[model samples]
Target: MGCFAFKSKAKNQRAAASGARSPAPTSDGQKSKASSASTPTRSIQELSDERGAQRLRVFDLDELSSATNGFSRALKIGEGGFGSVYRAFFRSAGGGGGGRVVLAVKRLNQRSLQGHKQWLAEVQFLGVLEHPNLVRLVGYCAVDSETSKHRLLVYEFMPNKSLDDHLFNRAHPPLSWRLRLQIMIGAARGLDYLHEGLQEVQVIYRDFKAANVLLDADFKPKLSDFGLAREGPTEGKTHVSTAVVGTHGYAAPDYIETGHLTTKSDVWSFGVVLYEILTGRRSLERSRPAEEQKLLGWVRRHPPESQSFRSIMDPRLGGRYPAAAARQVARLADRCLVKNPKERPAMREVVEELERVLQMEPPTTTAADKDGDRRLPPAKR
Candidate 1:
């Protein structure tokens, strides 16, 4: 999940440094082949040069330390399987005395299972790939000391944190139905860009979950955390044969069972998040009852077009959502969650369906809508 650390008023004197100037933009023919590989085998320098004019900064460890207050505990905003994230503010030396810039610095845990390899993968992919929905990598830090190695990544600070916090955290006001649809659309566009927007490379977001969807000040959704991202199947290849690596309950069943990854795997995970948006519960929650613990299983019990489907609507919405739109979303989710990978709708199709649903007006609340509130308690699972 995206974390937020407020900036301390103290001025950081550490001078920011920029990497070597990138060469002029290269033609598509000159682009490196390493990027299209299933695993990102290219180094940052290689990819950065290939990007041509898109230079990713090489951050100094001491400068990052000063920005983060020496990695103080109080500044930590969030933590995940990979490492801890700290919010920081530092003046841009390249700006020539401009105001301090905010950043989210991710410090990799030395003991974690994914260390250098995952870190490098992020640098390789995000260092060159640019999109409105993808998080911007401001810079990165790799330091070696006598005792240990320190690896860090710097990204643009997402002010609103993650979609997970807003959806499931009772502390925050519940998301309005329209707002939920807006966020989903933005996220779908991001996935679409990865799958089809790139010239020849199809980036499969291996870990597509609510936590990875970070929101900015305007509530714009941006996909973050590329540690588990991979390039999709190459020419003539049906799928990329690799070990399955993704969050539990979010990975596609086919990939989880056979270790054969494809773009369809990401579609499955997107469907899970779509359900989470409809019903404020998480994809997987062990604290609840066994039957309700798995979101997919619980949702399946309430099929679309059946009376039971109303039970899946988030009660927090208070019948303010359009019934027709909700049904359309449910049906879309059903298609996305189909058992056969071939049966699932492509992300582009999912985006178009969402756009159509967004255009529909919410149904006027009637006796039946009110009854929906009483039909099922908000899914705690």
Candidate 2:
């Protein structure tokens, strides 16, 4: 069952973050590893079939149960429509030198048919995909029998939670302007890699949103949640005409209307998030006044170059961010949100532009310390 079937009105084209069919469930069996040769070097299926197990550890149901305290509610740290994620610590397969590893375990909801598909997608995709800005799938557990079903994934535990948590939650302090730039750039670079850095395959990250961008101890951003990722059109095909599915606000208009999946669709979502970081507002916030209910419609009224643009800047920044850089970021975001998908800048170009944003010198006031003699250097990327 897919989310958001094609509708008559674009407004009616909203989407769910995850829901898709899959190859009939993979049988419950574990393969012993050969060696560490998995890479995005070959086509997705080729890599998954040949070497995915080499890169992933197969956890027995008993081990995962013990590590997660029998899936105790107290240990759960995150959950969505599909499943709940729990924090756990388990010793490595090599008990002597490996010590205990802190991990995040995601357990699928047995009732959700879509959850099973997503679990398989994560197992196959994350098993082969490796990058500093991507959450590592250390292992997985699958048990499907007549009496019980258990599908779970174990990932390196991210200490800082997600960008969405920090950006919107009041508990955490606001991120420094430089830190914000560094984080988004890392995320965009990850997207760039998915789109263009691979050997022969180009991945379209259909779900690109702050919630999916997790943060580490140092606040570096890593894009997680590969449930909706899809391969780009190949063999001269312009787009992958498939079911429209992704977070409603982040999905591109072209994809929503025509099921035309492409790298540009992810770029469009990245643009929405760019404005989000700058404005500290969600794509759609109904609690806000009618004029500001929709972020894009509201922001168009105040172009980045206009004098009122500063009013839209995240007040949490406390006037510390460079005014010029903010305008430039907004401009880049405008290019990403262009109605025509073809006109949107590629992820590589967007990343290069943001890198330049870091090189820019900040105004004295924005960089000065309380003493007014020293300057805060740009945040380290």
The top-ranked prediction according to TM-score is 2
> What lDDT score belongs to each candidate, Candidate 1 first?
0.75, 0.76
lDDT of 2 by residue, 126-235 (tens): 76677878888887766655465667889989988998987889898777677777788889988987787666566778999999999877677889999777666654
Regions of candidate 1 where Cα sits further than 4 Å from its true position:
1-48, 92-98, 362-381
Per-model TM-score on C-alpha atoms: 0.83, 0.85
| Pairs in clash, predicted candidate 2 | none
Model 1 TM-score, 2 decimals: 0.83
lDDT of 2: 0.76
Model 1, 12-44: lDDT tens digits are 211111111223122211222222356433323
* lDDT of residue 21 for candidate 1: 24
For every candidate, C-alpha RMSD to the true structure in Å = 8.6, 9.7
